[model samples]
Target: MGRNTRKRRSPLATKVIAGAAALAVGGGGLVWANFYASAHESGPSHNRTRSAGAQVATIQCPDVGQKLRKVPRGARAGVDRELAQLDKQITEAYARLASTRQAQSGDASYVQNAILGPLKSKRTAALDRIGTNIRRVGGNTPQGLGRFAECRGMGVDQPDDGNGNAGNGQDGQNGDGQGEDDGQGQNGGQGQDGGQNQGDNGNGAAGPFAEDFVDINDVQPGSRDLENGFAANGEGGSQGSFTAVCGVNENNLFNSDNLIVAPGVDNGAHHTHDYVGNQDNDAFSSDEDLANAETSCQNQGDRSTYYWPVLRLQDGTQEFDAGDLGGGAEGNVGKILKASEAEIKFVGNQRSDVVAMPKFLRIITGDAKAFTNGVANANSSFSCTGFEDRQVTDKYVLCPEGSQVVRTSNFQSCWDGQNIDSANHRDHVAFVQQDGSCPNGFQAIPQLQVRLVYDVPAPTVENGQVQNPYAVDGFPEQLHKPITDHNDFINVMDENLMNEVVDCINSGEDCQ
Candidate 1:
């Protein structure tokens, strides 16, 4: 790659050339001197052209006795070699990023899962630079040469989010501090070793998986993952790992958009994540899976939202119920509380006090001898409704990410608590408290409402047809994929049409 300097022909050089020509007309010794001087000052006009061709052909001389220098082919090759190595490096970095994502998101530990997507997106962006550079590498323009030179030594630095190489931390900070069950270090999690392990329920669907978030935009039409499974394996793709597929090729298999379930999907024949085959009467079957399937077909629908009927229980008897507040009811500790308009008003009024520990309440708790921050074991008691005088003598509760007091009734509340006992429960629990007692000490039994998040992919579209077989039963056959229909052509056509109409009007003709 070479730079083309579009140097303007100087007026001084033009003047000198004209003057030399005039002197040459006199046919004296001054003719040669003026001619030499003018040539020296102006150099070669052909070499100074604005085009790239002229630049490669230009010969530059340093001084009166110096030899004319030409660009060496070896130098150019050396630059090409450097760029090639950078290209290779970028590709490998992208691969590692993709693999890391596969390992992290696929039912791995919580810490590993958070970093994968950001890392993948970063590497993808870096790889995108290679495409732009590659195109410039083919040109002889100045920018093209500069870009090639810039890429001569480009490489990816494994991203570090301030956390040391110990790995597995959101913000690269220390993890939730809940160490592994096997007593492994930070990096020694279940989904490690390039995502080979399965059966680890880090925080995803119950199945073997890869470590990448599948973008719904990338799912291909008539793909199997969406059409067959319950919400594209929950992590957003088949086993949470995305296989790279050509966007336009008919045979390309990595179509993420194809993972979306269409509207009105039937669950009886839908595919499940278990490759070993479904057992125990569709253990994976659920209503949310069916609803997510239906969302795919309708453009206005959301793929993630799901609806289901509420079951009510009262006095050891179970029955069907309406919705929450908006005709809904919630089950707490084997009792179904109807969420009527009056009950909704009552709950809403108490929410500000019940949700998360109020600042004033926290100050009171902080001063208590029983309450300590990050301390493993200390038991006193924070004042609450039920356990006002009850002393929790031996339990240690760890305040995790969502540490807040939720007031339910005048005598009931909920909070996140970690049972410090190594034998009973090590993980944080969304405990609910009732009758003035929080779960651990002052909290009720049905503490926090736990909502498991899953990434449900969107439907795919090809040849103007929507592709979301996940919304239906049976595996869908692959369809033709065309990614660039709107941006490249539709936009251009819109502008063209506008211009044509404007032209016709200007020409005094009726615009079509």
Candidate 2:
């Protein structure tokens, strides 16, 4: 997509309300301002007060190392069944909770007491049962069975407080009828001016969706020109542009069941992913593992693992409705809904014979946390088809009538050429020049751009015309507001396909 063709909108507006409850001391007529403000502010204040009933409990995982035991061969089926049951239970519980909230018109106490409270208890019991089954099946490790169970209590009852606490206030406070403090340091008795600030939490924390790392303001528009070996007259039949399609990675929900960060130690991507390509790709999978595994890619040799967060329709059949299931709990309400579209493409490269990407090279692009933080770039584009002028950076993009909402992520495409991986999963890879060439000391690689098209239902679209954005699962409530989204990929390409890709880039020919 051309950046110039789209019209950009300013960041969302943040409204802060300031109120001061005054008290007159004795007969002297001295005044004191119990001033409370809600604008995005920085630093800390000693005057902050939280309600007693609003505290949320935190859950931590047990420490476990790599090399945890996999499910025993004979017990695999049973383990799968048990896990699936737990998944169904949790999904249904959330669905019921969602319904109750709607029925109560979002009465916080009713939702918490009648819905979430009971659901939490049921989930806890379900998790305990799953844990018992895991031990019986010989998958006995903190990272293995325990990790999956750990996810059962992974959420907070109250919404996120800008300062990392769990509270009910919109900007940050417990839901109880209590005053909110902006946490900004006190300037005697004066109140700070409130205004709309982009990508900043009221407490000076980076908004959940902010992309502070990349300076989007400095990114030059993408170009097709190849640098490095090209002559002024354009030698070697260079086309100045190239595009290739990586085969669609179907919703392979269970191939590499392990996760990154803590291989073998944890269940892969605590929230699931729609995986494609390599069969053996996982946190523990080595180059040899990928080399031996079968693949779904058209090029049997391409074993790269491509994946991203799953998208769901807001009001689809997957939505939670009362009595959908036999029990009081609904089935799969807040669960993973089937994706309508999953397409991955390689769009930018200056050269034809790019070098093969190193094995086990991990690259994460975009910030998943963007839903909570504001994006660093105004160009983190979000728009519905046909409504090109109303581009936004919010985590959720509400499409207009007769329009399909889409999210396009353009990843950096310059490789350091020497290191297969880096400590941060970035560093080794860099963005190509605006002219579509590799930077100094960095070799050109195909730019990975992924686009996800969503089919949200009518209720998800506000007023049946404007889009009603929602956040990806597992993000903060604030994230449900319009914000940024991101994706991750690991290089498990077959050596042969990698060579072919390089040859195509260096030869200046575009091929799928």
Candidate 3:
């Protein structure tokens, strides 16, 4: 009992001392926390007060309406920084999109023309090479003897093949198709000169091999006479000199030695002998052939058929006014498909070379007026199906017929206040009559037929090489500007761009 009393009395003091030490330590820690909190929340006194350690610790239950500081001393910045980064990304995206759109929808002809122009020149070069090769081989065909005969007819001396002998009319061997001559004297066997043994083939007639008898080394330099000409071969017979028999096929073929007559009729000189029934060998054989020729010729004429515009005269009928002249002059008769290189040649017997160097040929006196009209006004407008109607100003209307003027009143404005509707804004032309009859040096006509001539870029050269030799054939004439090239040609066709082509043509650079 005495021990229990002694401990109980003293234990209270021990408990009190322990409690005081604990309170002292807790109060000191609280004061340190408050001091740190006050220093951190020093931006402005208007801000809400902070707890002792809540400022640097987790705040599970923050006071209502208290705005938390967005960033701590070392925390990452907020929305503005992120927004800036996002804006940068957005700008980059837009730029990329713009570039992509341009690449996708930009000029097609210009892009294609860059590559195709050189190819066009190469095509001509290939044709020239073919001609050269034909000339080299002599006859229209690759057969050496045929080519030799052809060359001879053209006054081109053919050099003997390397074997030191003029090529025999029959592949080095004689007409008998034999090998080299044997040592059987003048009148040898198959390989021998059979004509020599046959009474010298009557009156010393020159045999087929006679011309070939010249030593190859003795032959002089030959000329390049291989043009696109054809000739026919003559018939063979038991009698007559072998040369005369085989020589029949010397100059009767068509198209650089194409067949035209029956064999043996007159050797090769059969221009008059109608072998295939149709004797007319001007250029084409039949109507179909003529059509093809005409098309090819036209294609070669402008490199772009778009230049030819149909002049529509208001007859209440949708016919093209090709040759409609107010005065009924052949020159002003119908709408002229603007003269193309081939057209110029076909109508005037002029070569493209005359016009190509200057990039244009002078308009014939008769055609000059019509050409001027076409250049001044040709309606070439088009539209897409789904999108707004696009008035195409980049192409021209080609009138296959003559130059006929259409009534100006007939040329109504398709544009009915709809700027984007192509059907409404397509190009239109009206022919104005003079004194309600005809104009100067002309006859009484109903209308003056005009066209919407598109602004097609003309072929050009830079540094002596073709810059845009042919654009319509391909696409996107060239690079630099969307509508113009360095040569000042309106390389693209569009409503706006068509004006450029018209302007250039009006200035006498591209059309006419």
Candidate 4:
């Protein structure tokens, strides 16, 4: 595909152009550059008027998975499989949309008829099956799921946070709707021939637009508080920490499988993920499979799995998966950047003591479709080593010389104390509140924070264009936005190791 600059749209066609999307890999909440024309806009009125005729860049579909939260256990496998199908349907539709730009330019309703219309039909069926699956087990089915079948055509510059508001009135970041599943799962069996051309979208343009980046110096020293009330100098409260050594994927263990979110479905993620910790993970891995699998962690007692989307530089390098399903074939192109460091830490709550997480406790922190879903669960933190105080959740940091890209995420630390998994995948755990206290009745668990550092060259913004943009792999509909960064984890830690973590945090001792 060619990388030509897009021509301006005609005013009359503004009525025809429509919507865009994200679900970055991680357990990395997906973050896209959400446009708040009112707050982010600069320059003359002519520029604003010129932008009125925006071209439809991608399709935005309602994340049905985020809505179904109480599926019965008996119906989960069936429901999950159907949800996976929904993701697959959207991927195919996006591929069609990406590959049909020329035809779209000539026909006002080409996208509606050629891509979105058929997509709705497929989604409607899958949603229907979801209801049937739940009802069969005497569970209450989600209502009005059929309403999500219709996907809108989102424009290149228009950033809608699923609501009418653009940018959520908070510098283009606001609210949380549990977001997408960071597009977990990959069909290790699929072809790696870059079967789909997501990079150029058949229009010869790379993504992240020039809007997804901002120089770190320009980002205000953010007020993000990292201190969770641990004793400063041998003080009280749970002050201990457990740092698990999970190498930065020294073993080329890469996949798109997300057992927690979309079990039994192959190639479910549709985007590549770099995995560490549990070595045996895929769409079909059972709890037993994970517990028995090899581990990347130094402690053999921990078989936990940690995975997130791989970061890539848009420097025209095709990785080995370039032609495979989750790689360049799905629009995740470029050279994969290995983490200079992948640090996994488990810390305690400042307000209360920690408890052992149930075996197989599954957690997915951050939202994958936050670009389209809004900031509700947006938890990805991007910063530079020296500029750690200035972290941004929606935009990737354009670090200065001597600085490197850093991605950090704090998984939900408050567990419901009963179920290990929830229907929306979020009901089981809650984030610690501003006061570092868990919600009422929710027990505090060792908060897991995964930090990844990269030495990729910093992207430079010249004349409002990014020269070397780098981003996490994400769903095609959700443009590779930094806000879409997310991460996933499954606790396969043995009972003894789990107890040790709890004791370490409770005893105020930093342990291995």
**CA-RMSD of model 2:** 15.7
Per-residue error (Å), model 4, residue 231: 13
In candidate 3, what are the lDDT values of residues 1-512, reduced to their tens digit? 00000111223233211221111121110000110111112221211222121110100110100111122212112212222222222222212221221221233232123322333343334333433444443424122221211100000012233233442111222211122212211211211231112211110111111211111122222321111010011122011110000111122221111111111111111011111112222221322332232221112222211111122111112112111111010001111122121111110001111001111111101011111111222222221222112222221112122321111101211111212111101211112231121123322111111111222232222221221111111000011010110000001111332333334322324332
TM-score against truth, every candidate: 0.16, 0.50, 0.14, 0.82
Q: What is each predicted model's overall lDDT from 0 to 1?
A: 0.19, 0.39, 0.17, 0.69
Taking the candidates one at a time, how many backbone clashes does each contain? Answer: 52, 27, 96, 50
The digit string of per-residue lDDT tens for model 2 on 82-187 reads: 4434434444333333222123332435434554455446555655664565577566533433333332111221233234343323333222112222232211
Give the Å error, residue 226, model 3.
40
Candidate 3 C-alpha error for residue 500, in Å: 51
lDDT of 4 by residue, 5-77 (tens): 1222123212111122232332022122222111122332111221221234556777888888788999999
407: Cα error in model 2, Å? 1.9
lDDT of 1 by residue, 64-140 (tens): 10111222322333333333333223223322322233332333343223332333344345434434443454632
Residue 316 error, candidate 4, Å: 1.6
Candidate 1 vs. true structure, TM-score: 0.16
